[model samples]
Target: MAEDTLVRVEHLAKKFCRDLKTSLWYGVQDLGAEFVGKKKEEDIQLRNKEFWAVRDINFELKRGECLGLIGRNGAGKSTLLKMLNGLIKPDKGRIEMYGRIGALIELGSGFNPILTGRENIYNNGSVLGLNKKEIDGLLEEIIDFSEMEKFIDTPVQYYSSGMKVRLGFSVAAHMKPDVLILDEVLAVGDSGFKIKSFNKINEIMRDAAVIFVSHSMPHIANITNKVLLMENGVVDYYGENITDGIERYFGLFAGDKERVEYNEFATIEDMKVYASAKYADDPSRKLPAIDYRDPIRIDLDLKLKPNVEWFHIKLQITDKDLKIVGIYDSFQFQEAIKNDRDLHHLKITIPNSIFIDGEYSITVFIQQRDPINSKWNLLAVYRYWRKFNMKASAGLGYVPAVVYLPGQCEVV
Candidate 1:
């Protein structure tokens, strides 16, 4: 590997042996059908089932270059990261790297559950090819940066989710890797801490060749100098920056391309749908002054296309920092509506207490819940369905002050 190239992924490929339809019934049915000396096509199809997680993916990250990986879920971004980290071996091809590599695939992923946070930090450092002496030298810095001073001795098993994340991130950040891969690890942290973390990341991005996997388009576009847009299992497009790649990627999903959602379904022929952050509510309105503390009002002219039974909306909200605030889905809560009406109006109010004030984003997918015992008629799952400046009200800065502290300082 050249000194200028921090990491190079050459013809990388991965295969997943997906047991799509093998079941107890398949065994019993196979035995019964074998009595008649007939080999069923269903069993044969299941035997040959394989899914490609990544296919001949090739790319390079130059030293100090930030690369944004953007795509729908199940895209090869995370898999690529795992391969890079040596957590998972690629079935074909190779990844060449220079210098120590630091990765945050998931919150506390490499840590031993039984170990204390203090121990896990050292353990994760060792996994990243760091020596105990190195970890010891940087121990105080890691703890101080993570702000896990009080809970450092306690076993990570008892640590809060946010604390665990901070600890894990601190260890990775302190590793001083030539290459750093961040996969949505910033999702769990307090506001003030997250601000600090973002600043730290910016500092790191300046020195290391960073591979950032996130759903926040604006963040990617704003931070990274180059963007790799992936879909299915291949690179769809590459751009000079995040904004271009995202615009090109979403252009593939949108049918009419209207500011307002033209139709509920992304594609009527297959009933496919896709969306970005803005479309969760009214797309036409860039940044509406919605009362964050009060309930959010929404009304949609819903239509049950033929045998539709349920509706699910996958909503992702990001704060002003481009950090992912939360991801919510309606299917997690409500049951499907079973009435056979062609068109039904739905007016619902989401309690605004959940989200803090930064501009929220949303993506929607409507599906019939479960149909085994109930209704198997419309149990189809859609494969691929995938925010702007807001004025600050007087009381707040960028986002509305959803949080009201109990005490305040009196002006002297």
Candidate 2:
């Protein structure tokens, strides 16, 4: 391990048995083997009803570095954090830790339910090796930072989840440990507290190593310099390229099937999307790729009910986070459609796409205008009907905005 490395994990693995009886029996057998000094290579291998919760994981975090641990639920992220925090022992490998470690891995993990919040603060401080006088010096700061001064004397059992998060983060961060481990505990905090926590994390990253686990990509992007993407108890991707890591994380949840809401007024026969600029087809990506700001064309084939005179089309574009970024309405530009036959072909063209570099999906709506109320009635709808990727030039890096618009600035 390098002198600057505060935490190091080598081929760390852990497993658990599904059945309680079998698990207890295995534990006894392992204890017997340990007592007799009988060790076998197969001991680390999975037995019946056993599975690896985390396997062959390797990573290192040095001072001033933050690692974002991201994956789908049940991907062994929490398990890995628990092992790092010494709450559980690894079954197969080793972990080296230097200096004091502060962790908010679980809500109220270090707090006693019967203890008052003030007492727990001192208790946690002492556990982190701070003397009573030193804790006294930091007590007021921690209390003020937590913003739970009113409830400082209240028993922890009465604290809400958010309150616990605030107090837990306050103690862990203020203790000034060399390594910090946080596991989605901030998600329970309110927006203001989250902001405060992130600010504190930034301040701590100047000297401490951090391992943060979160499902939110925005938070991961903002806080982590490196990323470790996990899947099925193993490393899926691990690198400093945060953008690539985020993209791969999004890829895990790709391949969304087209879902449509049916109605008797109209039926969509087929839909296709095209880009004016050169298209890049990558088999690994679930959606087709096009250059950023490329002109886009959407073609739709519809079968309408007899005598249906008009309908409106709407396109709602959402980013990978599933937040709506843009919308297109046919009624904004085109008049009511005059259906001459049962079958119709419609083409919508966006001459200049404003979408920045990222994955995006389109939701389509087909509606008929009610003659009496002048309101639109849905004839058919498509949820996440199509997905596409936009590849930008090298200069645009990690665009924080949803759309990119070229602009020129002049000094006055």
Q: Pick the candidate with the highest lDDT.
A: 2
Clashing pairs in 2: none
Q: In model 1, state the lDDT of residue 26.
A: 51
Candidate 1 residues 94-141, lDDT tens each? 788888788888877888888898888888787777788988999999
lDDT accuracy of residue 272 in candidate 1: 17
In candidate 1, residue 260 scores what lDDT? 30
- Local accuracy of candidate 2 as per-residue lDDT tens digits, 186-226: 99999999999999999999999999999988899898999
* Error at 67, model 2, angstroms: 0.3
Summing lDDT over every window of 10 consecutive residues in candidate 2, give the lowest-scoring window. Answer: 275-284
Give TM-scores for every candidate, taking all chains together and pairing residue i with residue i. Answer: 0.57, 0.95
RMSD of each: 15.4, 2.0
Model 2 TM-score is 0.95
The models' CA-based lDDT, in order, is 0.65, 0.88
Off by over 4 Å in 2: 40-42, 280-286, 393-395
